[model samples]
Target chain A: MHIQATGNVYRAKAVTGIKTVTDILMFGAGGHAAAVSDVIRDIEDFNISGVIDDSPSLQGKCLFGSTVIGGRQQLYMNGLDTMAIFLGIGDNLTRARIARSLGGREFPVLVHPTAHIGTNVSLGEGTVVMPRAIIENGARVGAHCIINNGAVVGHGSVVGDYSHVSGNAVLAGGVNLGERCLIGIGGCVLPNVAIGQDSIVSAGSVANRSAPERHYIMSPGSRIFRRFEK
Target chain B: MHIQATGNVYRAKAVTGIKTVTDILMFGAGGHAAAVSDVIRDIEDFNISGVIDDSPSLQGKCLFGSTVIGGRQQLYMNGLDTMAIFLGIGDNLTRARIARSLGGREFPVLVHPTAHIGTNVSLGEGTVVMPRAIIENGARVGAHCIINNGAVVGHGSVVGDYSHVSGNAVLAGGVNLGERCLIGIGGCVLPNVAIGQDSIVSAGSVANRSAPERHYIMSPGSRIFRRFEK
Candidate 1:
């Protein structure tokens, strides 16, 4: 796999020895991963190493200047380099699967110092908390999660690994989310709501009740999004 | 005029630079000043000599262990030693009034390292940019302001002095606000919305139009709070 240097600062783990050559390996090369790659590139940090994907159409080509570095079997950097990693998989399950496969390796969590973690909270490794996101006190987020830009995780919430909480989404207090979930942009998950794993919450929708694992579309009048006044 | 030896960190600023038998001076001992005093105490980097206020009800009482130093006229610490001064006023006109009253004595601007700032953003002295607040490119924020936690300022936005952008509020591209404006929590101001100074926007409101430079109440429809399965 070839990595075309983009003249940007390489992203490294914040740890002492790892920051010197902050290269980053991408886990998935899909649309969500592409968007995350854009943020990483724009952030003035992190160098993209290469992607590891099993898609036949992408196996031979480069995504974001990094070659598809073959399948899961061929992952790893031949012990020649030290780098951090970001899980670019969309679904939480995919993220969890990939994370377990690579758990022995180091994937430092990336919390943009700009994220607002209120009074007391614990966010685990491989989680990327983006700019302006708010994780209120008593919130617990597991590994390999993406709390995107301007997202809000209200107080006392628990999010399992491989969950992608998109930009401007709000999760009220006591909300519980299972593994491999995707909470889309501008979505609101009400307080005390529980969602099972492998769920896809659509953008701008309001989730008020308990939802089992998998996809649930908000029907008409389920949520209100429009307001116009000075 | 007197430092009462209050133990709280907020009162410690009153004792910062006082040798044996020290006197403290302060200004605008109000709700805003109370919080500002707390931060100053945390700074421990400055000296609070005394206070200056004409409010009759608070004139004789001791705040943070420092007595109101006989109004604005007697604010000068006759023979006391001080490292710096603090402008505890929350109003733009009044804070500026007191700063001008000091004639360049120096009040520190506190910019939290966690605050996200874009290129060409302007901030004034004594302004505190709270954690996770995003000051976008070319945004101008004036003096003695409180850009609170998780607040977002979009590109080309102009925010006036002593303004408080509450938590999780989003000001889309090019929003302009006047002095002493208070934007409520979880509010969103659409692009190019011009709001005058001293304006107050309630929580969970999505403002799409220009507002006068005064208090504006927003009534957002009932939010579903969360999404769940049907």
Candidate 2:
């Protein structure tokens, strides 16, 4: 039941003719959902019809002006075949699990207008690239990934499915991130480094070398280089 | 002789009418120059006329397809009044000194079209905001600064004159960076922290506390938190 993007279907589109606005259902209601909602509002191609959250309390509540229409039950409604869905969740494993649960649903790529996606890049289905994020030329971002605000996926890099490159994180050129990995806030993976599935480069941490699956990088152990004269 | 930007004259312009391309002179031919030139090519407002480097060997050489026409002498040439100048240098002290040397010349603010400058953001004269950089709401970036590639000047942050926020660096909300400071690549300044003049937060470092003038913060000495089975 895992929904893999067939071909280059989710690549960013260049609108050459009349604009068509597609109604999309946002799949979460957390902080990550709010961030993706902001980006979706900025992009001209997508209209947020409703937010889908499983919480009974949130069901009928307003999320960023969109109605919390219903939960996974709405997925069974007719007319879902024509509508697109976007995963606004941030957690790697949870996002991956939910993405796998969907059956043949159209998951469209949502890229903020301010984000720069270079030529020859392949963005997989249901991936949401946030404001000011950069995916350099020839990079491949797998399905259901979140390239968060100001994050950089450098040239020729491969971000496996369901990975989250958090705000301001930098995956330097040719770095490979395995499925369900989370590069935390302000984390940096140095050039050509490869981290396996479920690995984490912690916030403000630098991964200068590769690590195997499920490794955690602890960092920002500071030293005062110079306390200058007053 | 220091050329101060009069009023809000250097703000990013919205071209609604017929496009008029301004011929711009690049002030340096270094690596920073190449980066800014790449951004300028993406924005449709300005055309790169030539490059100016003080290095004698670089004179008449090519920089990113622009000819290294001449050095400081071109600053006084006829028709110079119409051409805009951009300081393509990265060094904080050197950029400041050179900016002060120019008198009455128009130093335009060059922001890549892909960069997101939010409401009420003020980018100072001669400042170059590189690709995918973000200046959030009510933030004020000072004159002649480099907000480098994928760098985030968070909401309400203040970056003082001649500073460089390096690639993928994050200045969290309300962070204050003083004049001639350098926040290195992947450096993260935590929310509301203030670093005084000539300070440096080194690459991959996190400045979680305020520092006084001329301080150097070093970081990213790492440790393994968890290593998993292959």
Candidate 3:
């Protein structure tokens, strides 16, 4: 099996040609993890074996009725190759770091039943699409990304690896987002606009034009989009 | 049947005690009409008899495979009581005017199959909830309102009559919106903020505080919400 790599951002692919339901392990135990667990339950294609959070306090605890078995060290247990890992972390940087460190593991893409994913859309592995999100036709979302609740990735839009498109945000048609970026809650990226790597389109902000790496795009006044120093 | 009335906005209740499938008439034939048609097709409860548009050119034309039967005058033709009227107009005042002019008609509430309407939610008659919109638990949406695509009315929020919550907007939990209000596209109203009647929260803006009647709320700079002259 050939795997692609870029820095710490490895591009994971969906497990294909599998006949039976697979046992999946969740990698984090946060609010986003709970949401992903809900989606997993809704999808019903995989059995959630247990949660694997690194925190010692969460050890032996429960998340959404799933037992928190242990930390990442548990992945090395018997039958590791058969069990798939789900990236449930919400932070982009931390998720990307985990993805890079944890190599050669299957990361299946999970999408909620209520989400509207149009034809010709491509979702990379480890990406979790929340309930009621709309991914219009011909859109592409990269690996380990979080397309949060009711977010709209417009037609032909491309979201890079480890990005988070927050709740109720709208990336207009043909918009492009680089890796590790965040399109905040209720954020609006105008049609065909491209946002660079590590940039943040602040909550309730609008991005009308393209911006460079590590910039902060926000709305200054009514219906205006401007770039400010981060 | 005892029907309740409040000025021009009579609260139309959902048709009850009907065993057989009923025919439904769409009231408008614009872009919003097209979206409402999509939702109707998804729900598959009522048969769409035809469309009623005021435009002369649209007469005899087809909307989502349904014939544009005629204007409001055609409603007087035959068997009107059996057929239910769906408010498909996007404009608040226009929809309210038509609702007022056409009295003694049954207006059933329409919600899309993809939408997540939480427990204890109360949706009034003639209200159309578009695809992927979310109405959280205990929320109340008044008569003839439009909850557009991917919009979110948070938990326990109350939205009044004839209002339009546009695409991707988010009204946080406990928010109250008065009649004929417009929460524009990508707008975010903070938790417990009460917007007055006929008020407008501009697109991509955020309302952190409550405002009185007929005012405009907009977000300036990154996260500050303020009132402006409409």
Best by TM-score: 2
Tens-digit lDDT track of model 1 for A115-220: 5666556667777776667788778887788887788899899888778787568999999999887786456899999998888776456799989988674523
Error in Å for residue A76 of model 2: 3.6
Model 1 TM-score (B-chain only): 0.65
In model 2, how large is the Cα lDDT of residue A223? 67
Q: Between prediction 1 and prediction 3, which has the larger TM-score? A: 3
Question: Which residue runs of candidate 1 sit more than 4 Å off their true CA positions?
Answer: A1-21, A24-109, A113-127, A131-188, A191-207, A210-230, B1-25, B75-85, B92-105, B112-121, B130-139, B149-157, B167-175, B190-198, B208-217, B220-230
Query: Candidate 3 residues B88-194, lDDT tens each?
Result: 99988899999988877778777776676654467777788787787764578998899998898876689999999999899866899999999888788866889
Tens-place lDDT per residue, model 2, A18-104, is 234478888899998898888877776677898898999999999877999889888778865556678888888888888888857
What TM-score against the true fold does each predicted structure earn?
0.54, 0.62, 0.59
Give lDDT tens digits, candidate 2, residues B75-174. Answer: 7888765576888887899888888988566787777665677777776777877776778888988888889887889999999999999788889999
Tell me which residue pairs clash in candidate 2: none
Model 2, retained fraction of real contacts? 0.57
Preferred candidate (TM-score higher): 2 or 3: 2
Model 1 chain A lowest lDDT segment of ten: A1-10
- Superposed by TM-score, candidate 1 places the C-alpha of residue B148 at a distance from the truth, in angstroms, of 3.6
